[model samples]
Target: MWKADIIESPPGTSYRSVMEEYGYEVGKVIGNGSYGTVYEAYFTKQKVMVAVKIISKKKASDEYLNKFLPREIQVMKVLRHKYLINFYQAIETTTRVYIILELAQGGDILEWIQRYGACSEAQAGKWFSQLTLGIAYLHSKGIVHRDLKLENLLLDKRENVKISDFGFAKMVPSNHSLRSNSPYRQVNCFTHLSQTYCGSFAYACPEILLGLPYNPFLSDTWSMGVILYTLMVAHLPFDDTNLKKLLRETQREVTFPSSITIPQECKNLILHMLRQATKRATILDVVKDPWVIKFQSEQPTHEIRLLEAMCQIPFSATSNRHQSLDYHI
Candidate 1:
């Protein structure tokens, strides 16, 4: 297993110097989170711009530092796809951890919606299809992205979807498999359900809100339903301010805005995904749904094969600064 390497920096050393030593010219801060900040930087050796997530060890909880952080890095390291953010390298110091990632020039989906309002069915279908493909790729590898919010779905310069933020992602045991005869059917093969509750309240599924040990894969689909709904309408399907009301809302059928017209097929797909945990649509189902397929010019078989092939190859750390160390829980 890969472990974070802790390095001791010289007295009074700055993060900038640390990054510079690794051949990265740090630029302005791009985003901020509870435990750290993301910076836009130029990798001199690679001659490409990259995003660096600088996580402060002191600010993060022990749970995150020990459990989630390691898991996130492990998951990201193995993932490689057109629709997913690529993980480049990781550097750990006494006070901080630096994660180097692909820079998506276009901002997140939430920011796009905030500025441009709701998208048309055609546009929504395209983005949703891309998102579904990314989720399918993750599911194929037995990795579940528990947090599938709009903010986590970023875009490249071409405006294609790139799934980001694997902080809440976890890999399921390899004993489970989707039925070969009916791959699109809702998956119930996993007997070992996930109990940990994570992700934003608005994007969370009913099972998660009810504090049930739920199938993490299905929970991801439910969040995708919320994202699809948000893309059609300019806002969230359920108001998250009141937990009671939010739970009640999620338990029932998702309602659409009468003011904006949505295709019947699209509505049907959303309904299938947003329903009860046992009946929710799997990632494969979403990919095969007619509404989602309408947006694709060609079949996704090639892309699916590509993702599967990529997963077979072992990931190697490219940076000399990244040295493996022993990890213990």
Candidate 2:
């Protein structure tokens, strides 16, 4: 049994020393955020390279420390999918919270687009299909990844898509269900709506931009539309420089570039996702789209079965734990 080790390092001890005690040799920093830095490390027990996000308790806000941080950990603990970054473990200390995760060596999708400039339609289709599968799995579990953008989509060594960053993710209220009996039909599953206007401005939906209570799942699909659009053009569909313009642009039709030739099927899918929130395409709808079906390798049934099996495994059985602490920044 992997026990989650939530311990406090002794006075004067460094994070590297604490990680070393847990069989991880911390290496160079790979990524950075407002309150944390992600380090590339080697886990001796597993003999594999991993990414460790070290968040400083002192720098994080009270809301983050008391609410979002715990929720992020809780959500990551249960998520298991090929297209999602695998959560290894979390070790919290007095000063820092260390989250060990699967390392996506190929870097984020944004970097790839920056380097290669827009992907070919076939390549974008593959990545989009993989992303849809991952999102479907999350929606099936009733979890909404409120943040979905090109920067959050990472790639492994094989260039396979791996969805990362769960800081803004939230589980739907217990009363509302997100699952549907048919994979092709859009079910009115969410009676309750999310008011939290979270995620990048360019990827945010019109409902969120207008401060309306929006369906979280549908908002996620809106971000997917942005991602797919970005994947094809190597740039965001809408410019987010001004709030009013952004709102106007989202409400209106999304214009495509004449420089690149995009297939009608692909354009149609993007339009469906970027349409009105009430009439937007759900994740299931994306999965069933002709372009997605052309690249999707696993059937929707396989994803459902995988999610069901993962749900059966208790969190305690998979992670180690020490004493819990109440923290406020």
Candidate 3:
């Protein structure tokens, strides 16, 4: 609910000044990853909750700024879709860069699954539509989210999904080849073709696994399909403690148990998504699936309205405290 426009960043001010201006009190560490650590913060000026990602300056190597950090910021800046996380303003100083962002109190989809087991088809379908809509919007903007997994998908208190973390994101120019050894360049014309394997190996598609230049957007669809399957079964389709065995299982087509009776529409969608590149479903094809139609018809009456409230209303200007209730406690 932070008012983005009024969030000030002044020249020569330190990181502490930036947080203090917005009345942000640093709290317990909520999460941490390679890029930085995130802290739960209370914005006193706005009387609202927010997540402040405090990026350690020491971690800001040349490779990180050129390839990872810039791309992450660019992707988030351009993506204004409903199912995507909202980025407030970034405050940079000699020692840190504090990224103020919307806080999803309900945590991520992974936690939900672990706590409640697999979701019913009706539940999975409801969430899937919102997810794909965001993905489609990203594709339209020519940005590819290389990593798409349950852990990266957060659900607000209202059960609305928000896609987060763009560390591995890529923005392909209009004329850039989807499959090529082109160098990734940022400011100052630095460039390098990626040789190291990237993204979560379990969710990675065949092209990435084979070390070929793959279309990140297309690979995401396959990962989404896997997530959909996990939501239905309460577990991953393929599982092996050994890394080699796990990769081999993922390389082959996913298989379900005999007793599980997934809906035909859901089955069709999964099959289309799991197909090899030459036969997989296109973005358009996914939107046209029958399961998607049925899924839309079944959304809880409250979900859409709550999400609209979150998107359109900023907590800073409002006198009401109920806005926070839109997220789960």
Candidate 4:
């Protein structure tokens, strides 16, 4: 039997507190993130399982505990999307904060990839299209998810991808598209998204590494490119232990190994996304791309056999270059 963690609840405070007051039943720890521990909990009235992420106020800086966390909560409450994980409820006590999220029982894409090398193009196409759609939702709402990585992409039982974790997300303020919006203008994750960059090093854009103000919208596109490359090749396109060298490599041309055979249309899209050009492929380019649209119109297939098939093979040359993935400047 699993014992639930006890948390004191004050009357009429928030959704979480009210739930806690009613003897909220919690299950075993299910996941972990940079800021908190996630657990499975039951909503007695609703009788549905949910993932509860608890963040301790003690570990965070005063500024973050008071300012940033509140902002994140506010933005998340208003911003809802199909492909993004649903934020159900939040409650802040004197010592800690509890966040209720949809449970992705299928686990995260990182675990999926580690166990299974890569998904077949069909699976990849479905997942990739969904990913871009979710991201597009964030951008449309003037929110920039700064920390986008395979680890943050959660999967439900249906193999559908959910973009989670807005801990480091910025809110921009604009109805204009990212392409038309002036990057030089003040950006918020909800409003204008920042010129200052802070995200996981491995997935960060070059402008972030260069120590210059960056375009938060474009930053996401770069990470998407890295993700697209990984989906097609089962490995990172550019990786170097030396951050300096890695940045340089990313600024240059990207190449594929001779081992894998990817169609030119897919390759062209990947290359277009990975380019360091002033004008890179936008969300429209990605969605309207011949390959993506094809998958969208086709019958749904949740076949992610890429990992299961390669489980027996000993794939080499993979490293977690993100060991020091802390935010840069």
Clashes of each: 0, 8, 3, 19
Ranking of all predicted structures according to lDDT, beginning with the best and ending with the worst: 2, 1, 4, 3
Q: Highest TM-score: which candidate?
A: 2
- Per-residue lDDT over 1-329 for candidate 2, one digit per residue giving the tens place of the 0 to 100 score: 24443555565568989899889999999999989999999999989999999999899998998999889988988898999998888887788888989999999999989999999999999999999999988887778899999989999999999999999999876531233343422223233377877998999988788887777878899999999999998899998999988888888889999999999999999999998865678776787788899998878885455334323334453222101111111
Candidate 1 per-residue lDDT, tens place, 50-141, comes to 99999999999999999998899999988988899998888888788889899998999999999999999988998999898888878877
lDDT of each: 0.81, 0.82, 0.67, 0.69
Instruction: Give the Å error, residue 129, model 1.
Output: 0.5
Clashing pairs in 3: 1-315, 157-327, 157-328
Runs in model 4 lying further than 4 Å from the true structure: 1-19, 175-193, 297-329
TM-score of each: 0.86, 0.87, 0.77, 0.79
Residue pairs that clash (backbone atoms under 3 angstroms), model 2: 2-319, 2-320, 3-319, 3-320, 3-321, 4-319, 4-320, 4-321
Candidate 4 structure quality by residue, lDDT tens digits, 1-329? 12222345563465455556755677889987656789888877678888888886767788777777777777777766668888777766666778777888889888888889977899888888888877766665556788888988999999999998887776665433332444322222222225555777778877678765555766788888888888878887877568988887877778988888887888888888876534556554565578887777442222112111211122221122122222333
After the best TM-score superposition of candidate 2, give how far the Cα of residue 39 lies from its true spot, in angstroms.
0.4
**Window of ten residues with lowest summed lDDT in model 3:** 184-193
Please report, as a residue range, the 10-residue window in candidate 1 with the lowest summed lDDT.
318-327
Tens digit of per-residue lDDT, candidate 3, span 156-256: 88998898887888775543332134232211101112333557866776656667555454577778888888888778766646666765776567787
